[model samples]
Target: MTANPLAPSWLAPPADANDLAASVWPANARRSAADELVFAGVPASVLTERFGTPLYVVDEADARARARGFREAFERECARIGTGVTVYYAAKAFLSSAVAEWMTGEGLSVDVCSAGEFAVALAAGVAPARMGFHGNNKSLVEIDTAVEHGIGAIVVDSPIEVERIASAAERHGRVQAVRLRVNSGVHAHTHDFLATAHEDQKFGISLTEAPGVVASIRSHSSLRFLGLHGHIGSQIFGADGFEESAARLLGLHHELLAGGAIPELNLGGGFGIAYTAADDPTPVDVLARQIADIVASECARLGIAVPRLAFEPGRVIIGPSTVTLYAVGTVKRVTVALPAAFETAPDDSTDPSAHAAAGHPEPATAVRTYVSVDGGMSDNARPALYGADYTVRMANRVSAAQPALVRVAGKHCESGDIVVHADYLPGDVEPGDTLAVAATGAYCWSLSSNYNYLGRPPIVAVKGGAARLIMRGESIDDLLARDPGIGSATRKASTAPAHAEPAPAQAAAQRAS
Candidate 1:
């Protein structure tokens, strides 16, 4: 089979389009004897039939295992240096009450960045001391809330946040533990938008300013300094950036020891994961050992004791444990110009002789199929936001047809509302086919929106052949319930004629079902 000239260089024609890459899917994902895709023993067809299309299916066992794996890996490595490690599940990746419970049950702390996340964790019964609050622009109310709840540690992003946290702690008549976030100037090999520790980013204060901020934090009677926090970026592949950042942070940590005791150091987590067959992310255990050695050696070089460690891993734990399932709504094949590097001999169908007879020029072209799904940017915006690439496969059943290059699109109004940028699916893919996008468990739901009035999908956790809704999908009514005009009109029209029909959104939703 010839490779598609239009496909990305990193994408290769698979030996079998139906085969699932183990690294890019949940641990329990497999093709059953019936050729149906199953996650955690629940078939994809069963999940879509029960939960509807455009659903987020998470493998409960896979997620829980990752959480436990991270905790164990870090603990084991840090134990070599006579120190302990705290693994904080970064809630910004994907958080629900069930996920919060799962993480905590695995003995991992929760790291939340906003008031809503903090509230969700609290409601899920996550201990206040096991939750760390983080945000660059945390409002006074947020600080007050964190202090009121006696949160574990508030990561202060700027110098002013130190005072804000201190004021809030003073008001609560308690001393709050705080970590000063600093940019170690390590340029991680990642997208510019994902890199946070670069000097010009919005996330943290400069390494030069961190010392003064730490002094100010210690000056406050209501604040206890918990050392420094540094995050390089998201979706990072190797530990080179982490090692460099650790070396820089340790330099600061050594200097800070002159002032007072700094017990714990947090190297924020941006560990990467395999999103496609082309990705080879460092395993968690290997990453733990590599980073542990880097920090230990750096501390030894600086003649400073290794501080207790903390990490905030979000995507690495949750990203590969779930998949987004969508129903194909349309399929269109369009002729596109092939790259010059991929130019080939003119076939009879596209030959200059046939073109001349038809009054057209011979073109170096290839057919690219665009498979439109029931959902798009409204459900997963990573493609539009970061130009993120994802892999897709026919989930309802396996196919024996030849592989065809495909662009999985969404039903949104925008042209950029792509789901999978480029991948190969069975040539027979058509409307009503269930397509599953692998490794969508991280930011898809967390960054979802209501663009084009599309209702957000639900997240279902499947385990032991049992599926349970961890988060309910939003309906049209849920979207309209917040509109003042719609609510008022609905209430006023309640006394109208009995033959009146349902709202347009409701009717469309009913027809969709």
Candidate 2:
């Protein structure tokens, strides 16, 4: 990055802005003579003109293929190691009864982090035993519901959670299987991972605190301690991270065995998928083989049996399968100079270059390409949250013109709300044309909100020129559907975590005290 120091390595100057980059996009995505973006053989322009702008078009075949890839890969790798394996598609990435049915039909397990997700899975007809209930702060009622439903496993994040789950399981007269989430403190990048002795994350119990929980759960007849689980982080493209995580988790397993404890092992997924040229997420088959190899060797070294492997990858399985199609609402060409970070940063630095434009520093007197679309932070918040970068193209038409450095933005009121940070676009890009942002199928819709009171985009599944609506857009009336009947009064909005259940506040006046 010429201007920014921390620019991601995958950002690059596109050789052809009009051409489709196959790695980050669906296999069938292409540009047609009409200059329209086509996915699954349907033109995005046609979809927009038919369905309107700010729509999410999922390549149904592609999504199914990705889910199958992970399932088959893990199955094959586990067979080679003579061990058991399971791939739990994290439902929070993007869920619908439609998607759940597809995943279940392909033989993949479902991992739900919330009650709403569990409800969707059941409504979609996925078997209860194939569902894995996961959460850091699951309510007692949630645990009771999962126990009553007889879901597969509840990943235990804390000892208190184990107690609640055990109590709920006992009340139901069922022995609930549990996995302890261990914070291994492994910091992993795309190509490198370091296993540290101490971890400082909020999600999991310390290694020291975990064994006691395992021992505690072992004492409870109503609960079954199935294994150890560790999720290092997300968007990792290399095997070394898994290797580090696996070896460390097994090391703990060995320690547990020495204390007469034999448990399964769950290495949580952050397996990377390419969002742009900067990302090189490992293929599912290759990554599974490598991780399986690591676990096998580690078990041999520790003189223990190889434990079953579990993965909960949301991005790799669903990310590349879908793309967000948007209509260019406004196009703004801004004059900007390259920032010092991009120009001065070293090549090997994994830092963000505040001035990087399309993997390089913004040049002095550079004409930045800023295209505004109908959706912003409401549709996808990763960019604004992590300063993440993305790529977009002229989806409605093809341009045989030179590429210009541009930033794609949304119509939200926040100046900080941007979609594609910096990328090359054909100079002639304009309004009324369609734009398809790549690698959004994972986090975009899953994290979408009603910010600015704007309607959330509908998710439409596209297959063989046929499209079906999965989730309809919200209306103003839908936004106010739950309003209280207090005359001339409105409750103050709460700052609860997104996607988490709402924490409602009472509006009672206490009868004037």
Best by TM-score: 1
Clashing pairs in 1: none
lDDT values for all models: 0.86, 0.78
Specify the poorest-scoring 10-residue window by lDDT in model 1. 493-502
TM-score of each predicted structure versus truth? 0.92, 0.87
Model 1: per-residue Cα lDDT over 326-382, one tens digit each: 877778998886554554555421233323446555556777899988888988999
Cα lDDT tens digits, model 2, 423-455, are: 877877776666789888888988888887776
Give the clash count for each candidate: 0, 24
Misplaced by over 4 Å in model 2 are 1-10, 258-263, 338-364, 485-513
Q: Please name the candidate that would achieve the greatest lDDT relative to the true structure.
A: 1
